[model samples]
Target chain A: MHMALKFVLLTLLDRERITGYDIVKTFDSAVGYFWSASHQQVYRELSKLTDQGLVNFTSVKQGDKPDKKVYRITRSGKQELQDWLHEPAKESPTKDLLLVKLLNLRADNVDVLLEELDRAIKNAQQRASVYSGIEKTYYSKTQIAALELDDLALFLALRKGITSITSHIDWLHQTSAEIKKRVANNN
Target chain B: MHMALKFVLLTLLDRERITGYDIVKTFDSAVGYFWSASHQQVYRELSKLTDQGLVNFTSVKQGDKPDKKVYRITRSGKQELQDWLHEPAKESPTKDLLLVKLLNLRADNVDVLLEELDRAIKNAQQRASVYSGIEKTYYSKTQIAALELDDLALFLALRKGITSITSHIDWLHQTSAEIKKRVANNN
Candidate 1:
């Protein structure tokens, strides 16, 4: 497993006590916007974090459903995350499939490029709408007034997602307009 | 090898006739800004493209130096690229390590978060500067005046790269300010 997964789990646990299922749900909800991990990977990493003393799990008895293990960061886990977070993360080139396709454009295939651009714009708009919904549902005005530092952290992440997507949509529109102009000129 | 590498090479070869060495160099330059490919993956994919008849290469023998195999896109390869470019790409969640780390921030570790944000800003600025340089060198006003559709394609990609990075830097600064304000509030 990637060491990044370990830190992702540890950092998540730092926010709140959550069961393995909640961890997966959290990923699907907001964390998915930044990084991805499989359910198996999350469960596997949870056990490893337990053994390493980075996290501890509590068994809560339930009347009907099976007892669940709620997990949270231990002292050592917080220490570990603090140390790791201070380091400068290396940036790698992000793969934008539409941008790659854009480089394949030819003069005669202006419509093909336009078709691709339209699809890309639709995709980005869908994402931005979903993100906007998440922001409203999870970080409402009332919630914002009462936000803890941890809540602020997630809020910031959500904000980042919306802004980035907005930029992509802007670029898509600009590219579309520029291509249409070039076609009009027949240069 | 990933199928993406195949298209990356074909799209590149569509622009010019270049050897295996030149492919690697191009990847490091403009192409490297969007997608990543190792030299070995590129070499492997090049041969696969040759076998598939989507690309052809000419072996030019040099004096004392080893022979060079220069590659070019076949007609079929252009058709392949054009067809693929039409399809709407599935969007995946990009892995941004810093954003994940931000979700782990605590009130007491404001300075730690600040340090991380500082590093992120530096990394982004460095990349944005490099891309700005590429834009100047490869797509100057004089060059833009005479650009073919292929050059325009690359220019659009470069322009997209700059806008995206600029947005990230803006986010980094805003997040830093917001975190500091929260620390001050202590509410």
Candidate 2:
């Protein structure tokens, strides 16, 4: 799991040859959904991957722009990604900020926490709507049938995100009610 | 969020005065629910916190054993926790290996992934059940009412975990079915 960055890099390279800057941009949008890394970190990892021979890069010159290095996954990198895909997935540990806040909440702050929980629920709803749009665009039966394996896999990941967010929203409402009841009783 | 280690240390200190070793043990069981840190990292963080005056420990000698430094939260630490509790939580980026694998899946690996998904579903079910037992034991309404703010916070965190795992289990089943359908169609 700690080598998640490597997988992210390999996954990107598997799609198309890319430069460090391109990887950073892609990470901010698509890959950002699943992972976050700094531009510097991406460059650092790219260099390390190149050094390890898991990835190789070639210089590309543009007419008006400075020359750039475009990286591609080596055979070893592809093999590594395949091996990792077969490993059993462990549920990631909890790192939700709202959950952390809930765990350390003071009695006096119950009202504020409830308000924040409501906000979180609304946020989750917005995210779900956004993800559902993507689903309709790319993961519907017709689309899924047409997609190649890589695209289909991404669709599956998007599906998980949508499903997980929807469930979290449901729980937020239920937990909100529960907390409100407790507060009422205490008062 | 990068200061997560600080919060982890404070959360434990707020529970009771505990040694670095105790923190390692607690992380493996209780704190293991939401966060992970190596034992060496825990020791390092404890020393850092002590230096920062956010936490302080007194060295106590044990007969025929080396001295132990038991740490406790300082006033500053408590204040910091309160401040953090009020700060809005950003959605932690997704890092689930299953999702990552799914995003990069190969066509031939569908069968293997389905088997693993089934295993993951079982694991989520087991985790949810375990969390339910803990809820029954320690987070019943009566127990919650009697608990201090810190305990209540922990209860709330536990609630989120249960909700999340249950949701994840539901998603896994749904995803499994979807994958099966795809596999059948492809075959």
Which candidate has the highest lDDT of all?
1
Candidate 1 ranges beyond 4 A from true positions? A47-79, A137-146, B51-53, B137-146
Q: Itemize residue pairs with steric clashes in candidate 1.
A: none
What Cα-based lDDT does every candidate model obtain? 0.84, 0.79
By summed lDDT, which 10 consecutive residues of candidate 2 chain B come out lowest? B97-106
lDDT of 2 by residue, B16-73 (tens): 8999998888767766677777889899999999889999999999988999998999
Ten-residue stretch with the least lDDT total in model 1 chain A: A87-96
Please tell me the TM-score of chain A for candidate 1. 0.82
TM-score list, all predictions: 0.87, 0.88
Query: Judged by DockQ, which candidate is best?
Result: 1
Candidate 2 residue lDDT tens string, A72-184: 99999888888877777666566565665676666777877887898898888888888888777656776666777777677767777777787788778877886777677
DockQ of 2: 0.57
